[model samples]
Target: MSQQQTTLHVELGDRRYPIYVGASLLSASNLIAGAIKGRQVVVVTNETIAPLYLDTVLRQLPDTMLVTSVILPDGEQYKTWQTLGDLFDQVLAARHNRSTTFIALGGGVVGDITGFAAACYQRGVDFIQIPTTLLAQVDSSVGGKTAVNHPLGKNMIGAFYQPTAVVIDTSTLATLGEREYAAGLAEVVKYGLIYDPEFHRWICANRDLLAARDVDTLRHAIQRSCEIKAEVVAADERESGLRAILNLGHTFGHAIETHMGYGSWLHGEAVAAGMVMAVRLSAMRGSVDVDLVVELEQLLVDLGLPVWAPQDMTSATFIDLMALDKKVIDGQMRFVLLNALGSAVVVDDVTEAELTALIDG
Candidate 1:
């Protein structure tokens, strides 16, 4: 690893894997080469990202290896069983086998679909995560929660298959659009809200630097976020208990994504709004002060994120969509709500009246 690079690992015992975060690490063929489990490699990415970083990644693999690149259309709408089937078709046509190591080289949409493909293809194959977006770098690419969306609910079908390694090159953020970059920050801010109060205050204090995309600020943010997630995943790999806290705003956010149609709102954008609603509900339960909700809303607004759900979405809409959420168990609905700033809990006792008030009020 270079002096500029930071490496952390997800401790899944024999299945443990490393996450590399740094500047220009994509050019480091050694890191990429070291993670491959076999001589055959398959790279899965989207059209938008393929043009940007695919070649650089391809260059890292030796010519002696069988490297096939499958590029799909970009967008959340493309994350479906059909796209996944198309990817399998291309890989099979190229004669890839169980020995192939798949690499995911894009943002969340690309990463999730690719990871899920790796999990199911040939009964599971080793895959590396080359997450190019901030959201993927800090969140999705780390945990083993791989899946594609369904019309009724988000990430409804998937597996707990982990990656062999994760490579996050900070330089890719330079090419990201403003909206996408801000969307990623929503996840970064979520780390502070759920696990670290000091980090939360630091984020609020350094909003300008974060907005400016200062190199050091971003590195620290990505590294710390990964560390928190790593610790959590190490403790609860399958989200059986402790890990559910990671979805602090995701329950409400997923409902929004499904109701609005996939791709209508970025995942992080919906989560930003959802976090506020969760915090508002926490205040209603008297677990956290109402003032904290205002502070979080202000911070999200300052970071150029939405702090409210869509104008047309109603309590009825949210209830209907969220009822289909994957987190629901045995006819009971579970939600991750803040018990306090930097503390989150999963509760199943939230009454329908409370939810209606939280949404309609």
Candidate 2:
């Protein structure tokens, strides 16, 4: 961690953690090692990410630990029970006890699987989220939501297990493709739309900086998103009410992921398309102006995000898929809809006809 690096704290009673963000954080093994200060570490990553940053993270870890690694094939489709089992097998095979730490050293997919693995292994263990993807850095890696996908739905079986520390090295974002980077921006944008209007305006004003990956611009965006998410998580750890707000575009996004087949469209891509659909849905509710949809869609489009679903999925089919979102309670589909550009409302009474019209329109 450099002197210039900014730290965002997630104060949760005694289970508090810190999010470290900056350019060269990955190299600050001494600082990271000091925080966890443990003896047994298992860095869980994927084929794609392993060849890149895993070794660098392991090298930085304190000498007190015996670092082992389990590499899985990278992608959303791999975030499953069987893949999670790989970590369990490694932990068991390595004779690691409950004290063994798990490090998620990849994107959201790796972080989710690693976190869920940490939650299940020996009933639970400490894990560090070293998220490499833009999406993971801004959203998944910060929140305590960890899961493996069921054939039925995305993140259907998971736990709300917080990490010991969230080590976000923005330099890792350099490896991301154009589409992947844009996908992450969708999530970063979501935080502003849901809670901070000023951040939203900052995003709109400096869209070019974000698109070009300006260091200062990216850092602030990630920091704000994490701070907002951390606060919401601490208040409603189980997502009873407040935490559900974090799933603003997730309901529709999950549907896009499921219907399109996981891995075909990136999570951020699905969320981008999903957010556009949400704006249209909000417009139909008359809570938000039609221009909001136009603006949101255009921004995402200009960012190279997908603003529509695949042709194979019809409007009605998409609605049916959305009904299966994790946020649904008592068979009511709760939606986080924008009431204004910067504020949002949770409404479950949205009509299916309205959904079809918004999507089909």
Candidate 3:
């Protein structure tokens, strides 16, 4: 049975777009085809996903449309300028023009790189996100925060380009690897923590259902997560202030991804540990109770996520790498810390001593 589809919109004034969340949406030809502004479409995917759902998506487009598939190797390690340049090579070789619509057919890596390509291709073009992974569906694919990673930082080189639409097929989670699916849950937990305490509590109580990949449970989780993100993005499309709160654990998480090497620690795993750190720091500053740290750590553990930073990475290592984070402004470190569950604040007054104590302790 197909799950009921819920449609939400990211109201970006002139650029508002709809997000469709449900089961078997990849087969929704109308949803996919309607979003393309032109007859030219570029389906960008990776090896792993291409074998799984690429052909299925291709079958949706009408035979008359100019369709090209740019299949790249899969992995977070591959999100680089070198790979991006190569992607451009493929599109240009196909003679794709400004009318081309780039379709991202995999997880966050594919979505980020493909969106960046669309953003730069002919100065700008349309793109649709068919996020297969739970992580991409819940977080990365929704907000239009597109980018390729840099050696110095994660998402350092990117744009605030929105997708024409998002088609999330919940059934794809059935094919997702255990770790990847769990990593996605970290983002789900984040929504509850930073924006909705009741949602967080629901996630905790329903961990078993989520772990088992219950369709209805997963659908609710994805829809609610996207709704929160959409609300945040609509208010601050450029991350000027409010939207930055959406990056609850990203600063520390990005450092972990950079230091441990991209793909070594999945973005969501790093964020799990990073959230613990952020909450711990909040406790240190008396913004939130120290028990909130323990509560979050236990929840992550229950959700099969890492609750603490890697043992090999010292506090100094985190400090050094985090200094390079995109959130840093004018040499001041800003952290999104929770004053209470469901209430988050961005603070730049964190002293070095506080960081050392949080990480080293």
lDDT leaderboard ranking? 1, 3, 2
The better-scoring model by lDDT among 2 and 3 is: 3
TM-score of each predicted structure versus truth: 0.98, 0.96, 0.98
For model 1, name the residue pairs that clash: none
Write model 3 residue lDDT over 146-245, tens digit each, in one string.
Answer: 9988877888898989999999999899999989999999999999999999999999899999999999999999999999999999999999999999
Q: After superposing candidate 2, which stretches have Cα over 4 Å from the reference? A: 1-3
Clashes of 1: 0
> Between the candidate structures 2 and 3, which one is better when assessed by TM-score?
3
Q: For residues 2-73, could you state the per-residue lDDT of candidate 2 as single tens digits? A: 556888888787889989888878886465676665588888889998889877877887666777889999
Overall lDDT per candidate, in order of appearance: 0.92, 0.84, 0.92
Which regions in candidate 1 have their CA more than 4 angstroms from the true location? 1-3
- Report the lDDT of model 2 for residue 85: 78
